[model samples]
Target chain A: MNLVFDPAWLPRLGQGVLLTVQLTLYCMGLGAVLGAVLGLVRVYGGGRWSPLYWVASAYIHFFRGTPLLVQLLGIYLGLPTAGILVGPFLAGLLAMTLNTAAYQAEYFRGAIQSVKSGQMMAARALGMSRAQAIGHVIMPQALRLIIPPWSNELIYMLKYSSIVSMTALRPETMDLFGVARSIAARNFRYFEVYILVALFYLAMVLILTVALRWVERRVRIPGLGTPGRGI
Target chain B: MALLRVENLHKRYGHEEVLKGVTLAQDAGETKVVIGPSGTGKSTLLRCINRLTEPDQGRVWLEDTEITSRRTDINRVRAKIGFVFQDFNLFTHLTSLDNVRLGLMKVRGMPRAAATGRAMAELERVGLAAKANAYPAQLSGGQQQRVSIARALAMDPKLILFDEPTSALDPELIGEVLSVMIQLARDGMTMIVVTHEMGFARSVADEIVFMEGGVIVEQGTPDKMFRSPEVPRTGEFLRKISDLYGESR
Candidate 1:
């Protein structure tokens, strides 16, 4: 297997890496905000029969049950038919953001539920209104609890982002995967180009994991989240 | 008028009736100790006073204001009435000082410095001044309960309800929590404590009320109830508790 390739591809691949990182960060940031709200709605939208709860649940179910490829294609190609034409970058970004938000919402919901009910009772007993109690007592602990799961989501989103390249048909919209595919097609060295692309993802994922683990440790409240560690 | 009043409170959980039209009153600076077997609704009664557990029927009054009324603003009422739970329930994410300070700043709108000072004072009262920066998980069960008490105290509540505050503690650690309650009672804090600690009930309670089957079966001055109870069941329950706990001093 010839490992040698054109040195000129380095800059293009580096640019692809940069774009991939940007896309992941943007989707994650915006997805977290959107997901947190949706998670709250699913948990506190007032029982099974509630219309808002049903709506949120249905949205989550649809995104989770369907294919990411179809979603990207639908937004990129299908939206044009609906007269909502968007460029490849915007379409890919939108598709990934909406998809990740559904997954992140479940993570947020689980994190919130993992918080002991007693905390809410104690907060309410302290004279905090329900909203105040949720914001001050519940969310602080819940956000900490979410670190482990949220980081998992972060890594998943990074890898899953390769799927976004299918929507990026234009040269300017190329992510690491898109750039690699185009280069592989021209050079006909599928093995070498794809292997290098895999390495880029692996490197980025390793860096992210280490960075997020550090964040988890820094924000961790002593004797919280992990049980039996505290008195 | 009574400092706190509960009138014919009723609560039912599916097939079980937890509280069956129980009524009670407490005057300012009075400490009432409630005792009963598990499932007798003593905790439910305490929760009802603060509307933590809504009663199916009946009303609660703090001074003259009806806490059960829909317009009463339960948050304000809860602020004025402190509650210490069986499990301590200290905010696990916060240090002892922040746990105490949160209610003061968030609910009372006290300035941060003032809240800090007040929280430190309350922590000192609980003998936890040095452990102010420690999270609840780092503290012993006794210390955690004390921090929760301090959290309640920082609010300067008109009344405090203790729902088996020491029940969740080890026998050796129970004394530390009881001592704090005894001190609070000595300092003229109005309180209603639910417990099996006969020694605490005898030493500190202004009145001892014994409940069974969701009703107050007997109530009287601690001396009268301890020495000569009118109800046979109250004396029986007391004997059983003393036998199990050896009158927990």
Candidate 2:
């Protein structure tokens, strides 16, 4: 058991972190937008069995019901079968984006529903159309309620991103897990290498948790969900 | 045409009949208060007048427009008909000023600067100008209801429906909201109110309607109704309410 760590491996680890961060962030952006729109469609799309509601409901159910690893492989290998060929990066990004969006949609829908019914009635009474009320009135409050759950999605993606590398993602942008795996295989120090990678992931999650917890504090509605915490 | 007319309004909830064939009319610059037991549909009648709660059978008209018709642009009618709720229903996420300014800017399409000015004016009217930037969650229940009043007033609606606006407030706080309503009544605003505040009904309402068992049992001038209600049910109900709530005006 050679306990000696290598500084030379730092650059490779850094590169993996960059790629993983990029993939997580890009997926988060797409997920936020898609989730909000789809969540609204599910709850406020007028009636049950309406086309928009059904499509959003089905999409959420399908993605949420399946595994991320399976989805990544499906997009990477299965897409080419249907004449929709994409490179590894695109495949990973697309799969993560869709998966994140599905989960985010449910979170957002739950938050939206949690808003008191009086808020909707007030907005409608003030001459706002159903869309306007949901958009301007309901969404603003729901966004605050979503922070805790949405941040959960974010940190989950920070780690769930590791599954992307299993699907032929270019080695250069593979991820910290890949870097650790290669290091362990070459040096026969699987224990030490895996421990280091675990620390790296823990660091990412902690940083994100602090940052998002800060946001949840900033947007805290008084007398609502705030637990008397301050900046 | 009356400023507002509700004809043969009927509403049913599951197995319960909430409002049955209630009809009423009021001209411009009139204030009416509907007083009844909790489940008698006083709130339902006001909500139905604004189409907030669609009536199972009947029609409502604002001036010449048949507001109950499917062809009517509901937003337009709703814009002109303000509704203040028992729970205040202030936009909890927004500040007092934004609550007042939202409909003016968004629905009426007033410019931001103009909306702010108008919103401030209405806030001032309700004596909440200092709290304009304060969120509804930060305000007292009475203050929240005042902000809602300012919100409805900013729209300059043709009619305002107050569905027990002060019912949720403490006895001490009800005065402030009622005073604001008194000022609005004096200013010739057309309003329909549902309230347990018989004092307000006595002072401000041109007509006071006493309802029971899903029907309007009697209606008359406050003086006539308070002194001598035509129906025995109205007198009995009023006596019970006065007994429970200290006294009826």
Candidate 3:
């Protein structure tokens, strides 16, 4: 038996994609802000002066240690048992944001460390306060180097956001596979529907990679980034 | 009071003392050159003076302001002391013009237009006006060092410290950087330069300080040190460098 046409399901799948896009973007945007703050605290905070270092370290370890599936479930299901209730979509969004933030912070810290120590000294020696130096000189250069890694996180987030759909809540916009499941329940054409959804994900990732590569080309310094080229 | 003073500056790292009781004073418009062998604390002394490297013990004064004192604002003192590094540590991301303009706009709070105008003049002084838009990686070593000098001069510092400014350049490139140093001296910029270029020392330096064993082993005027030095170590050091360069004097 051959798979039949499913034009009726196209609209449902489109809605699912819109939800996925929303979840990915919100998570990434808010995550990046949190991550940047966490990364800076890790890099500049030193012995006995900043207690935030321990907090950042612990956050990264916990989020990165547990699987994202457990995290989503913990927020959606476990919270209700503890008498702390949240809407399904809200729980998923919150979990994805924190999960993404922990990973992104590590990438940012690596990029920040790659910046030459001399850059800070030169700025401070000029009498720019430490904050001003980090803001103007250090962050500008670090931001450039981080593009390649940061975009990787964005791309990763697209796939990572899929776990939100598995939560007990049925967010209409977020469940691409649920659209396939609904179609499968009717026609039992499970393979064809899911394959179509897989194609959509592949296409999205492909487009994202090309766009990010273009940005890297436009902004990269000739000899000051990556290894061996910089001080 | 002297324009800049270092009193018995001392620094140690795990029992290895880098600078021991090093002291010096500079008057305004005076050009002092420090000569020393590698690992002999020449750089440490300069860094301590600017508080770039904190001395384990000592005091530094920039015209009656106790820079090393706990109450003193070190940033203000450092702003007045322009430091030119051996590697020409210009901010790599910015253009030559922006590097010079940074301090004026950020530290001094000058408007962008005024900072740009002053930065241009400083670059022109180093004969690099045409390359203001070039990034540090785009320029030659000599040009990059010159841009670093322009960055320092743009601050209108009370005194400039050159930490082996031309040591990383090629022999031919070294001459261009040295010439700029000489010109700054001629223009009456108070400078304390650390270099091995005997020619620059003899031509432009008011006082030549030879440092060894983390101490000011000898000090004399340029002519006196070069011709009839009182210290055997200073004479031997000069001969060794002259042999390496093959420039008989």
Best of the candidates, DockQ: 1
Candidate 1 ranges with C-alpha deviation above 4 Å: A224-231
The CAPRI quality class of candidate 1 comes to high
Q: After superposition, how far is residue B235 of candidate 1 from its true place, in Å?
A: 1.3
DockQ of each candidate relative to the true complex: 0.83, 0.75, 0.68
Candidate 1 residue-wise lDDT, B64-111, digit = tens: 899999999999999999999999888888999999999999999999
Global fold similarity of model 1 (TM-score) = 0.97
| Model 3 misplacement above 4 A | A48-50, A81-83, A171-173, A222-231, B246-249
True contacts kept of each: 0.90, 0.77, 0.65
**Native contacts present in candidate 1, fraction:** 0.90
Question: Candidate 3 A-chain TM?
Answer: 0.90
lDDT of 1 by residue, A62-126 (tens): 99989888998989899999999898777777888898899989988998898889999999998
* Model 3 lDDT tens row, A154-214: 8888887777667633537356665667777778888888889899888888888899889
lDDT of 2: 0.88
Residues B121-173 of candidate 3: C-alpha lDDT, one tens digit per residue: 99999999999999999999999999999999999999999999988998889
Query: In candidate 1 chain A, where is summed lDDT lowest over 10 consecutive residues?
Result: A222-231
Q: In candidate 3 chain B, where is summed lDDT lowest over 10 consecutive residues? A: B240-249
